[model samples]
Target: MIKLYGMTGSGNCWKPAVLMKQLGQPFEWTEINTLKGETRTPEFLALNANGRVPLLIVNGRKLAESNAMLCYLADGTDYFPADRWQRAKILEWMFFEQYSHEPYIATVRFWVHFMQKQEEWKDKIAEAMKKGHAALGVMEQQLQKTSFLAGARYSIADIALYAYTHVAHEGGYDLNAYPAINDWMKRLEAQPKFEKMTG
Candidate 1:
């Protein structure tokens, strides 16, 4: 069986979990408390040089990075488009999720919710909220016309973005303002075998 080392509440960690569940793939989960310095331990670092959770161990080979793991698992699956243009578009959104979305949205969530440093990190949190909303605005514009990020079909791109976006409220970004994004999220949730970020 595949082994996934991750923290349950982490959106990055939640990415592959949701995808695997939707794909009906069985895997074992080993929770890693990153805040407790578990990821920095020699044992964990031996598995992941970056000392990050959401590591995938398959057949004794380790794979780190959440979006990369999603691509590996979704390859040749329905969630991964076969068409060249469609696949490229999916990759585009996935890249945007990492470069544009997660940096602000996920970071704010880590600070405000997980670290409970909303008061301490007030300035940083406020700045992150601005950038996070900008990212959501970009998403809202795309979702206004298409049902999914990678065009008309549901794909890994949606999964990548949804991982953090669905929980953006935890980061103090309001969802009610993005109607298109809201509806698109509903569409994703209605997909077969869908599961929430946390257990």
Candidate 2:
């Protein structure tokens, strides 16, 4: 069995949780309240030097970074591509999600959903939202050309970005304006094994 340390509502953490259930794997989940600095403690730091949520403890090995875990768990699974070029494309999207998508999407989600844009984060929300929209546009353009991020098949590349793109509206980015993303979201939702982060 695997053990996972996560915050209840975190998009990064939710990625593995949803995938585990979708994959029919059994794992233990320990909720860590990041708002209370639970992850910064020495105990958690030993697990992940970065002190981040979405830590995966499998076979006594601990790993951090949500996208990394997605790739790790997907070994020998359909979510992992068999072809070298397709596999590279999957990794490409995973890297894109971390560098280009999460900063804006997750940050804006924090302001709109949790803080209500009430603090110093307020001044930067608009700009962040703009970048977030641009990131979605990048996904939209790819999705329009291909059925999935890598190709026709669903892969961890989809899982990586799907972690937050589904709820980008929580960040005040309108999905209605993105027909391709909206359509893609529905397709993901329609997967028979689909599991949602929030009830």
User: Which predicted model would earn the best lDDT?
Assistant: 1
Query: Tens digits of per-residue lDDT for model 2 on 145-184?
Result: 8888888988888888988898787777778877888788
- Local distance difference test, candidate 2: 0.86
CA lDDT of each prediction against the hidden true structure: 0.91, 0.86
Query: Pairing residues by index, what is the TM-score of model 2?
Result: 0.95
Q: Which stretches in model 2 have alpha-carbon errors above 4 Å?
A: 118-120
lDDT of 1 at 68: 94
Stretches > 4 Å off in candidate 1: none
TM-score (C-alpha, index-matched) for candidate 1: 0.97
Q: Highest TM-score: which candidate?
A: 1
Question: Backbone clashes in each candidate structure, one number apiece?
Answer: 0, 0
Per-residue CA lDDT of model 1 for 6-118, tens digit only, reads 99889899999999998989999999999999999999999999999899999999999998999999999979968898888889888999999999999998888888999
